[model samples]
Target chain A: MTEVTQPALTIDALGKKCPIPIIMLAEQINHVPLNAVVSVLADDPAAYTDVPAWCRLKSHRHVGSYELPGGGWAIHVRRNY
Target chain B: MAYFDAASTEPLHPQAREALLAAIDVGWADPARLYNQARRAHLLLEQARTEVAEALGARPDEISFTSSGTQAVHLGVLGTLHGRRRAGRHLVTSAVEHSSVLHAAGVHERDGGTAETVGVSLTGRVDLDAFAAAVAGHDTALACLQTANHEVGTLQPVTEAAEICRRHGVPLLVDAAQTAGRMPIPPGWSVLTASAHKWGGPAGVGVLAVRKGTRFRSFLPEDERERRRVPGFENVPGIVAAAAALRAMTAEAAQECSRLSALVDRIRETVPKIVPDVEVIGEPVDRAPHIVTFSCLYVDGEALLTELDKAGFAVSSGSSCTASTLRPSHVLEAMGVLTHGNVRVSLPRGASAAEVDRFLAVLPGLVRRIRQDAGVE
Candidate 1:
């Protein structure tokens, strides 16, 4: 598979937990251009599940999560509206 | 960390620690044995019983040690129910009784008995008239009411409720897990239950006080220990520690109560002023001095707790929508309060006014940030 690299807005939610990471995504997703990806970096364990669930509930595009070089995750979401 | 979850558990009191260490050496032998070492253990055990009963305003013979407060509630509720089974199998309790009593009622219903729950008011107080009506029925084998709510700290009208139960010829079991060591339980209660850890005693020791002639027999099969009220070998060291802690706490109760009450008042007054859309639950005047609970309308309890934890405050919540459980707090629900984003701050005996003020300083900005991130208006 081709290495898929996309330009994305980044949010540093590291050390923040669920509802927080999701809350950050909800607030900033609209600032990104339509169909552009927003990346949330978070360490709270609950964010792994809550971020994806939030995306599904809000009808946003879940661009998938990737492990950061350091500990924690980079969960990617795309603004659908 | 400012440990504001004392209702859950307090740090062991200093005297409890010393007594526990001393008792471990002397109380290791079985008090039920007939040897010389056993005689010493028996003496220590009897002394512990006397200490606990005196603190609780109970007789030494009436106080029996159980493994935990939940066990005491189980034995108190089920034993009384079984002892009065010939009269009726009906059990009555406030809807907000601890899960232990509620679970006991569940067991009663499972065994071909009936159970009824009385509701609470908006302030988390039991509706006394409704409680009286519930126990007024002819078949009410037992009625359970907490001295103060564990989550909200609302003091129930136990004395009045006890009188009603008396008129109805029903035994009243007061679950004083939240208040027993820190305050005196109102009189006229037939049976009482209290936990050790909540009042700075060691864990795994609970007191079950059955007033003489209350007509309670063990629900479980006969056993030699605790006069068959509680089965299994006694926790002699834990009992000694618990009794010592109770005595020490009672000695300082009046002073500590006023001090903690002032601290709680500070939090109560500050939280609403700092945070928007917050509802502070529980009766302001009639509640326990150590506990103050409030709810934020648009905040998530687990997230708030996480933020507070990061800010070095350990607290608890009654909101059902926390990360571990999706159900809202029954106490909050019964009281008709906002059930989401609830936080309960219960000051331990040594919690300082400075620490509480620091929490108050940090809470508002954090709530604002979370709400701003969530786009909550």
Candidate 2:
């Protein structure tokens, strides 16, 4: 269950392996705090576990993480700002 | 004939063979049984645990036996992830961990947890900056890094990675599947696992050790065996043999490792020079001394492996043994190297130089044959 009605940025981090995706999204999320919403796209299976957990530790709201048709995920995240 | 697949499974050592035969009558009884035979079984089990623990520089109470090295990793990874679930759901591991650890990460995700993957460089090393950043965002539960890759023999900097994991207060699980029987993990690595078969020991015996005060609890259903970390009836004879073999292998390590290291280094440096357009995998400096891998362009790896076998060489193909998939070696792919004609020659202890010379003598001809068949110049 995700908390909707927050600022969003669709960060498509699909198919990126390891620290590459994590670093990209972290840099992207730093630009604008409140309205920054990242929808991460990833093909790496580990990202399914890594992303939401990243949300939990950062105090940002993990809105909803749903899979796309081509095997990537659309994880909507909002900056804690 | 020269055999170079010891990384997969070394043949049984004479010490292990003797121990296996001796233990058949004495250690076959269930350790849990109250009878005399059972007491003997229990004593053997204790001795095995002590020897293996000492080899890994671990306390006796910290070690638990599992059915296989794969099982040990499965239990160790799952236990660490579950135990630290409260810290955060993100688990961090390298890209080139064994299939067992990869699958365990899958199980972790199936339970609604997430995993942060660290990428390896073309040299088969994890990027430290990336590693530092992966754990920065989350209360990472555990970070799993193999000591040396089983296929390419690349050693991860577990010490540096462990330092980062410690900074995030995450427990590090080191799969010393290749190096545990040969090298020590030393001050780094919180949890360690190894297979007996990799070190000329009997198959079906694995050691999983967790350091004291670590937050690792098994995900397996509660059981009376192995302090509830691993649950199953013991393979007593295999355990006894594994213990005997491990001791023997490590005892000879000072001399044998240097001998094999020289052999492997000669192969690593000379193979590419002698055989044209062959790319060797794994870090030249930071890898196991027993394994050397290379890809011959334009040749089918399986065909090359078969050709080597026909030439009285029992080396291994890095290509996945899954015939149905028919894919090239994943290890080579991750290292960003050619995957077409990958051959992983893992020298066993006591392998002679004459056999190595014979194999090398016959290698370039086989490579040309396969390359010609594949229509590649």
Candidate 3:
């Protein structure tokens, strides 16, 4: 069995719309140390694809996404630089 | 206001208006009846059918008028599937097809038929190799592809796709709603669908053409009208006007195509430079001549459209904020492009260079203001 490492930070953007979640992610991703993972909790449907696409465009790594028990998704991203 | 939403619905052409008025006076009588008025109406309907067929490169008997483009798509997709039920219950379509085709595919799936959507490239072009692979099996009954993307204006390889479908003995349905009047329909499609309003004709008029020998059985309740493909009393005047508009637009397509291409090229090249963090989406070249889309970073799509409306420029967007479903555009999502703060500018026929320049001059300031308001600057 593989061990799951916890995220260094979690952004609770559950009620926010698109581009807001993306903006919040972009503003806060740099606060963590290099190679640290950040999880963004978003309910917007656009966030599902935009988060992964944003990672590609910014040269960051989108580790994975997980569905939350309450709702929405936890999109995990690793800061590469 | 300078209208930049032509891809949604073009303003009716002068020729269409003239034909509509003239035909409305004489086309009110039922064409199926046996009377002088009926004879006149029948003649007008046949003449319109011939005109539309000539413009679309099909025989008159092959063309049928439907209520709307969406309806045409449903009939084309479901009808072909029903006709080829013995062959298989499998369907193939591109990932970025219009909602009409996608919805039809959804219906197919709900009815126990299976569908496979081939992925597209970053430029919004369908992956031909993947498309070929999807239709290789004998179980694949039909494939649907658009002549050009409505949102991004990227052209699909319909000729090549049609060839692949032929090799597999599956019929191909080409949705030419965006290209019917602007460009010549490429050969090799077994069935074709288009909307009238996209080409300067009135709304509520749609064109569906099924090539000879293509197996198609209407899924709707059978009626003897429109070659038994479409039911109910036809919108005769609308069909006449649509045909007139198609002919006029086709005659001027070459000149207008070049003129609009230059304007769109200017927009594609200028948007990224003028606006900070702007991504101009879609193919840089080999696209429809009139459409150019771009996404502005850290801006709300609705706010930007409202601001542009105040600035006397009408535009459309694929952003999630603008959509009623609150979902981002499937086209953009499939292409993995930016989906927020998006703007799609499609120029209509006779749009002058001065109007384009004025639009270009004012766009940067609006984007900057939206970004500032969002606290992104």
Candidate 4:
């Protein structure tokens, strides 16, 4: 079995609304090294769907999302180039 | 101001206004009464029904007027589920149906019934294979699909869907509020519903048509009016106006459709090229002629709409920031498209090329300004 790697960077966009989370992700995802994971913590409902859609559109790998203990989601994305 | 929100409600047609005034003078009496005035009123009501029915390719007896389109949908959906209870309590619908259909499904689910929502594609068209599979289940009582999507304007394959429902002995409830006057109601719908205001008729008028031999038992408390299908007194004047508007619109549809189609095509082709990072939503070819939707990547929908409004353009959006629920439009989410910075421009009849060009010219700058305000550029 392969060992799990922690996210290299985590974006705390908890209280922000839609498009903000997506914009933050877009601006910051390039900062991470290739194939490294970036986790975005967003409570806005649009992020749940738009983040994955954005990943698909931008050609990045969408790692699985995990629900935070507090009422939000930690959406993980792995950079592809 | 340029009105680009015809899908929300079209401005009243001149024919509808004239008919409404004439009807108010003579159709004020109760149609159910035995007086001479009532008899005259009944004739007008029946005449309107026949006109509407002809437009829908249905018989006069199949048409019933409801107070609003939402009511028609409720009755069409719940009544069918109730009538076919012996068959099953399951409902099948696409994910992009108007809130009326989805809310009716919600009510059914709350009342101990099961529902399955089939998803759509990136172009906002329903997956026919998935829809066929969803309704192929033995317990599905009814399936619902729109003639065309209200927001994105993608026309569903109603004929094919109807064939599938027929094979399964399931009824199909079609919400044709978007296409009733603009285009022919696609054939094979077991029951159909439409709102008058969408067709340049006055508000408070709705059409509910159920084909003969379709079993629809009303769930609401019993009333003798509307063949015991819809309860309450009829809006005779409104119904008359709605019928007149429908007939007039139908006559103009072929010409208006092509004109508006070319305008919409221009918007669809130009929006993406003129505005950077914009994705035009909905099917490119199989969509309704009058509506086009698009989304910008970094701008907020409400801000863009407000700026456009300031610039004398009235449009609608499906962005989370614009919605009261703070959620993106279910239709956009279902299609997996960008939901922020959304705009749905549904052209009204007789919309000019100059107006469309002006809109196209102003939109890119508005989007850019909104993006800059949001610190995107």
The numbered model that scores best in TM-score is 4
Assess chain B of each prediction and give its TM-score.
0.99, 0.96, 0.99, 0.99
**Interface RMSD values for the candidates, listed in order?**
8.3, 13.8, 1.1, 1.2
In model 1, what lDDT does residue B315 have? Answer: 94
DockQ for all candidate structures vs. native: 0.04, 0.02, 0.72, 0.70
Best-first order by lDDT:
3, 4, 1, 2
Expressed as tens digits, the lDDT of each residue in B1-377 for candidate 1 is 78889999989999999999999998999999999999989999999999898899899999999999999999999998888989889999998999999999999999999999999987889889888888988788899999999999999999999889888888999999999777887998899999999988999999899999998889898998887799999999999999899999999999999899999888888888988767788889899989999977558887899999999999999755573654456676676565657899999998998898899899998998878767765
Which sections of candidate 2 miss by over 4 Å?
A: A1-81, B320-324
Return the number of clashes found in candidate 1: 2
In angstroms, the error of model 3 at B187 is 0.9
lDDT of each: 0.86, 0.79, 0.93, 0.92
Error of 3 at B207 (Å): 0.5
Q: In model 3, what is the error at residue B373, expressed in angstroms?
A: 1.6
* DockQ (model 2, Cα): 0.02
Candidate 2's docking class is incorrect
**Candidate 3 share of real interface contacts:** 0.69
Name every residue pair that clashes in candidate 3: none
Q: In model 1 chain B, which range of ten residues has the least summed lDDT?
A: B319-328
lDDT of 3 by residue, B227-260 (tens): 9999988899999999999999999999998999
Chain A TM-score, each candidate? 0.89, 0.78, 0.94, 0.94
Which candidate achieves the best DockQ against the true structure? 3
